[model samples]
Target: MKPLALPSGSRWSAAHLCGLSVVLVPTCFLAVLFIWPVLRLLALGFGDEAGPFHSYLRVFTVPAYREAILTTFEIAIAVTVLSVMLAYPVAYLMATVSPRMARLIGIGVLLPFWTSALVRTTAWIMLLERYGILNSVLMRAHLIRHPVAFVYNMSGVLIGMSHVLMPFVVFPLYTAFRGLDRNLVQAAMLLGAGPLTLCRKIFIPLTAPGALAGANIVFMSALGYYITPALMGGPAQTMVSQLISFNVSEQLDWGMAGALSGVMLVLTLAAFFLCRGVLEKRLKRRVVTAARPYGEGLSGRSGAGWGMVIAGCAVMVFLLAPIVIVFPMSVSASPILMFPPHGLSFRWYHELLSRPQWAGAFFNSLKVALIAVPVATVLGTLAAIGLARMKGTFAQILEGLFILPMVVPAIILAVGLYYQLTPLGLTRGYWGLGLGQAVIAMPFVFLTVQATLRGFSRDLELAAMSLGAGWFSVMGRIVLPALMPAIVSGAIFAFITSFDDVILALFLTDVRARTLSRLIYENVLQDVSPTITAVAVLVIVLTLGLLLSSLLFQREKS
Candidate 1:
């Protein structure tokens, strides 16, 4: 039978209805599963006068809680400053280097992101401990007669967190630099502008938006950070996240915990908007200035400028030192954290394998992330495509809704999920953990895939249909192939996010479904062991392997 054709200008075709249904499924799923839960948690923050309000008043009225809030902001600001300083040169190199070198530097920035935050924080513990590698190296070199007090202090927290947050700064700056029109820089040079003049007058202004964005991203993420400060910083350096966790777990004060969480959310949002406004204003001013076009005189550097470039490279190495230190420490068999390892051995690798808890958690994380990755990728990619195809207030709203997960604090999301999923029989199971992870993973997938889809044209699909291909067949043979690069990239991101996430997993996982990150958290908080570094190294290796394989696969396919 011939397929029935919809009338001209009709908006109710079967294909359109199918598209709507597909979009609606995930939209409804998010509303019921994510939005409602978060709203409920927010509601708890403003409980009756005798409950959360009283707790909030006590918290606000108390000097201790106020100090924690101040400490959190202070640390976040310090981290942001350090990250920008360390990342600027790496980003500059990425923007101005040979394509091969650029790709290598980009990989360096991305590698840390693939590993779990808990693992990274624990690795810092081994490196910063009195008996740790850093102290041993300095003592042996006669740089210091005694081990330095590095760990359990603000210095360690700053170092570990700056390492973790640097990538956020680098990636955005790299993108901004890449976005620059080379011709504009050349034009400035052709007009006899010195390197300093060109940079101050041209390059810096153009990249300021990215710098601002990256700094805000780093600061906001650092504000809510739990692992690094918990592992590396002492009581004196405690941040608000630690305070909230303490209230919930140690004090069993849910009301105050919720109130504190709400406060954090408000502060983060305010900071983000404030930064965004300043960036937008600067960008508007730059646009109005109407700078000269690029590519007139593109080569040659002044001697003074070259010195600055060398200084930038030096800073990059400094930022990389801690991560670079982890390798030798992981292989040490001295039964202690010692630099140069005293002598290297594979004993830690053996120990990592022998520990059933560690091995079990690793496998469980792998299983859950493997399931979540593809599911999130497919859903997120389709949602991006569907949203792009439509145009209206509804489409814009839906797109914003899809991206909301990334902006919301993970702990807030976790608390909400804990309460909401319990009654639905999803709590404390693989399903619960996976679903919660997918919610967090979805925004990243959507962002990457949407950016990719923006460059794609729907004409290919129309052309395929005109040649007698059915919708599914065209999508499979043509559309999917075109989207493979984006799908792979988005899926890798989703997988890593699910693999490394601790907050949601902590709230959702039971004994039967614990993830590697949770295991690291438990080991650090309950039992500090050398074995933690071994597990951390393994996680880093696994993530690097996955990322390398994905890149190689993409290269071969292209």
Candidate 2:
């Protein structure tokens, strides 16, 4: 049955009177900033800019364009499969291990998750280069005489995509595994079910939520991947996103760009529906009662258990190695970038300040992030409060609309924002790009605040109302202070999300406002600068500090 539209309270009571104003303000903001721009882009594509079918027709007719679409599908699917295989065992280990051990291992898993995806991709680029670390090691071992062509090829694209998307796979599976009942397994074992049968019938069904949801997240996210493939993939490996960007910026072919984006959007929606259906059928809530001994639990130290532990450690190493490689590369004394450095020097770090372009990009990212973060934090916090207090389809629909920006490939938002901003001369500087990023950052902010609200006590709200405090007074004196940790975490996340962006920067910024990620992106393509590694290291440090602060705050709140 559909949920009723309002909560079980007086529509105008003090407790609920802050009410829809909270929803309306953010809803209106998203409407202007996100929905309108996307709808505009779609209209322009199918509109009379030449003809409705002009661009759509080209995607179908052109051989290279057709291949780009097919290759994108292949890469996304491969990334989905590889990430799950690598992440599942680690997630299981975390569920079964001691609390302290799980915490230690979780930090290893999350460092890469919280750090910039583009930074990680850049590190992989350096590692896989002709004179890069992997080749240097392989040659020293007499494995091969010449460096393999890893970058500007399909192999490089796959590795980058897998590294960046692995965390999405790990986090959801960890959640589901932690929530599973060990007692059920003991009950099944007592009923004469063997290990294989227990896994096939009980465990797999229980974990369906994480496996299916995480794969859908990875595959959909990969579908619009641009920077990794643009840098790592060869000319023959052009993707739908690259195709859209090229047509819009280079060819002035709006129709074709729109058609390609429309198709990608459709593909994203289709995959989500198909995955959701499977998850629902397999993961329906069920009652299973059982008792268990402490020593003999969900995962025993049988041969199979030992095998999984070994595999989980290996997966953790694979996930962490690429991110860890960049720090050593940054301080190398070689004029050219090198790993296993001949000598360590801070020259590249100093050079960042001396170079005008690098300084400009760094400051530009800061400016954009500063302007965007507070706005996203307020709007997201308010939306979370509103949705938590309300009920039914209207609230659900509004929440879904806010999250729409996250579900669509970022390339779609880039195209739409560029089109909407250009006509008003808003594309040249920080305001346009800042608004674009606020849209991008909204979901992170909303989700963080929403998670905190789920566990909040309604009794405090009721007490304040009984004492005759107004909604605004209750919010100012009670709720805001209570939610300080989550609010701050959400703001920090919004800041990094804007700062680390490159897709919108590629489309929206001119020479005056190119962001840090854009500069790294442009430099990696033209030349492998030592400064690129230095900048990545600096970003890694800043992001880690921010992440650690958020974690500490959450711990204190708990």
Give the candidate number with the greatest lDDT.
2
lDDT of 2: 0.84
Candidate 2: the clashing residue pairs are: none
lDDT for 134 in candidate 1 is: 74
After superposition, candidate 2 runs with Cα above 4 Å error: 1-18, 48-51, 186-198, 285-300
Root-mean-square deviation of Cα positions for candidate 1 versus the true structure, in angstroms:
3.4
Candidate 2 lDDT by residue in tens digits, 103-194: 88888888887788778888888889888888999999999999998877989998888888888888788877766677776678789987
- Which pairs clash (backbone N, Cα, C closer than 3 Å) in model 1? 183-294, 183-295, 184-294, 184-295, 186-296, 186-297
lDDT of each: 0.78, 0.84
Q: TM-score per candidate, in order?
A: 0.89, 0.93
* Lowest-sum lDDT 10-residue window in model 2: 287-296
